[model samples]
Target: MKKSYRIKKDVEFQKVFKQGASFANRQLVIYYLHKNDQPHFRIGLSVSKKVGNAVERNQIKRYIRQAFTELQCEIKNEYDMIIIARKPVKACNYHEVRRSVEHLLFKTKLLNK
Candidate 1:
């Protein structure tokens, strides 16, 4: 994903968390804020150390990012989304992570039909 497509700032993430609507499944929690001026969606990822060691956390983040990359065209274009990995995600593979992400997006009605 491009740097421009990511939500990297602490304040941005907090704004999304505080003002956005959220949805979740067993593996992940998603918080989203609609941004009318945005031309494309931006995503923030959070994978805590409680989920695993540094390597494991990075792997989970990679999988989530890859999932977003693949689903970009199907996602709404004007939202800021934050994805927080749950502890159960440590045991999940890429496919599962992708499915969980897809599920959350669907639940939040952020995916195009």
Candidate 2:
């Protein structure tokens, strides 16, 4: 098991929900909003019951947290991110999840921008 990227009690999530915009690719839906602080990225994961039961949901969350941790060094700052796991995620592997997140990050200009 891995420790999750702690989603602090900051206003980032609320800002995103109220003002941030979203863009989705084939694998994931990324909702992002810029903040005033220096390069801090908070991640939130959403897995619906339609994806699976408690066991499956937990598995998906673990995988997502792992993926984010793996990319921590490469990710940029000052953005709040929300990743919503779709049904396809349940059938995907860790690498697939990683690649999916990477693609979104790259596409959204969160890296090297």
Whose lDDT is greatest here? 1
Clashing pairs in 1: none
For candidate 1, write residues 1-113 as lDDT tens digits: 99999999999999999999998899999999999998999999999889999999999999999999999999999999999999999999999999999999998999998
- The whole-model lDDT of each prediction reads 0.95, 0.78
TM-score (C-alpha) between model 1 and the true structure: 0.98
Per-residue lDDT for 4-106 in model 2, tens only?
Answer: 3455454756667679788876657888878777546778777799999999999888888888877887788677788888888888888898888888899
Q: State in Å the error of residue 41, model 2.
A: 1.0
Superposed Cα deviation of residue 17, candidate 2 (Å): 2.5
What's the lDDT for candidate 2?
0.78
12: Cα error in model 2, Å:
5.1
